[model samples]
Target: MQVLTITTPWFSRAQEICAKKKFDQVWIEIVHNDLEETFLEWVASLSPIRIGMITESLTYSSDVHEKEPTLEERKHKVERRLKYMTHALVCDEKDVGYLKTSSRVLAMWWTPAVPKRFIKRQRKLASLPYGIFIGSVYGERSKIIQNPELKELMIHQQSPEHGTPYPFFFDKMHGALYHFLKSRLPGTKLLFLFYLHFLRAIRQRCFSLWLEALQNGCAVICLPHYVKTYTGRVVEGMAAHMPVITPDIPDRPRNRALFEDGVEILLYPENDPIYLANHIRRILSDPGFSQRIVEKACRKINNFHTCEKRVQQILNWVETGEEPVYA
Candidate 1:
């Protein structure tokens, strides 16, 4: 089968999957930070599978926006291109409604290089002296960081501690620019191309989100996902064998059940920081509990969330037309 993936910035591990799948026929479209797109079409009449995926939405959730020139301006165009793809593979299941065909990769999926020895080491250090929550602070998650326990450990991209990025909070002028660009940019979208160049020139820096994510791989975050993206933050945490605590989404019973309530992950209500705090205290005080949760979570990722395994999922989805059955 000719498998084509139209994705945003590609990862080294994920890029390797193409070589393993089908070498020559794969088409990868690069969209700019959810900001814009570069397009491609089939050189042939038939192509078996075309996947539209943006892992940066999960992997590089923090700094991607700082580098992103204008998401507000480019989102419609970028999203339209993704909508055009044969299969739209979103990192989270909630985003399915917006696209034509959607497949959820589930659980902040990522290509992890975690060593078994590291997990063993973590098991020994089951007190889990340190904890962290890194990434964008979207929705009520801002409130999550305010908890005295989480507040200290929270490392938000928008926070001054890292670097202040003026990404999501756009004004009316920017909004007008988006409307004008979408409506006025015509034909090959020459104006749009120029805009990307201008945007990149001003925004370019030594910022590397993938590197940062790699550096801070051991992070614990739990929240009610209000938006479309659920990054690989959860996977990153588990890869390092850290215990996870987060709010369970009411709609996704399967996701809630992915881990045992206290075994694999600790679930808390969205607005309740007291519950979140209580879970953390329990883990910190109970070394056995933390080890059990971390071990099981790491084992689950080893079985299901690898890059090779995720790619294989799309192939199954295309063949069977059934929801991904996470075991």
Candidate 2:
């Protein structure tokens, strides 16, 4: 059976896995109406399975703003597209609702690369001498640094002896931006593209602020995720028994679970920056509280983040052609 992927498989390990399994047809779906000739040539050289997909949305025009399809119009277009494909594979729950009724929409999670050595290492390095912040160091870090009230609490204040590296943070943003630019472009949607660029530039400037915080003895280690887009830091932090603080989105169950206060995870909503600052301060100042969360998180979820397990899950999904059956 033919497999049509809306996104390009280039540089995607997941694509490598899918291709290795021998899908009869694999479409990259570039979406460049003006560059159709270039896209066609590009796909011709790649595996015969690869194909290009274009939409009017890819064209650039002065009236693009007026011509922009509304959410309903876009939804209709997606429905129309679904009529042509055999099975539609979506990356997350956000896209699941948009797929057509007849299409078999499967939510695919990127398979994380957890080094076997890391799991074994975690068993030995079970004690977190420091707090860890694995992902982006965006406005998120300001909760601790910029909030004077939080500093007054001394709960969020770090001693000068505990300097951790900021390369991890910089690397994460770098990887994230690289993926972002490759996945999107100027003509896709002007405002969205511009906002993405603005956010990236903000992060770029924030890199120095992150380094300054680290120099002042922040315990956060900004590290590169194993698979560029996957949440490797979350798993790695849990493994290290480090108390982690990531912003929570109310709608996602897994994200909400991370904020089950005074338990394995602590939640902080970004809207109330002061509250987030206070939460960070509370953990920093109270050693017992911080240690408790780390211990609980390590015990509650270590086995689930294993790379071997993640690989097996991906392989199982590919083999069964289904979403993961999580218990």
Specify the highest-TM-score model's number: 1
Judged by lDDT against the true structure, how good is candidate 2?
0.43
- Please report how far candidate 2 places residue 320 from its true position, in Å: 2.7
Clashes of 1: 2
> Which runs in model 2 stand beyond 4 Å of their true positions?
1-92, 100-105, 109-113, 120-145, 150-232, 257-261, 325-327
* Candidate 1 structure quality by residue, lDDT tens digits, 152-192: 44444332224434343223335655565456433323433
Let me know the TM-score candidate 1 reaches against the reference structure: 0.57
Which RMSD does model 1 reach against the true structure? 11.1
Error of 2 at 278 (Å): 2.8
**In model 1, which regions exceed 4 Å deviation?**
1-38, 42-48, 54-79, 95-130, 148-219, 223-230, 319-323
* Weakest ten-residue segment in model 1 by summed lDDT: 103-112
User: What lDDT does candidate 1 reach at residue 118?
Assistant: 27
- Residue 24's lDDT within candidate 1 is 29
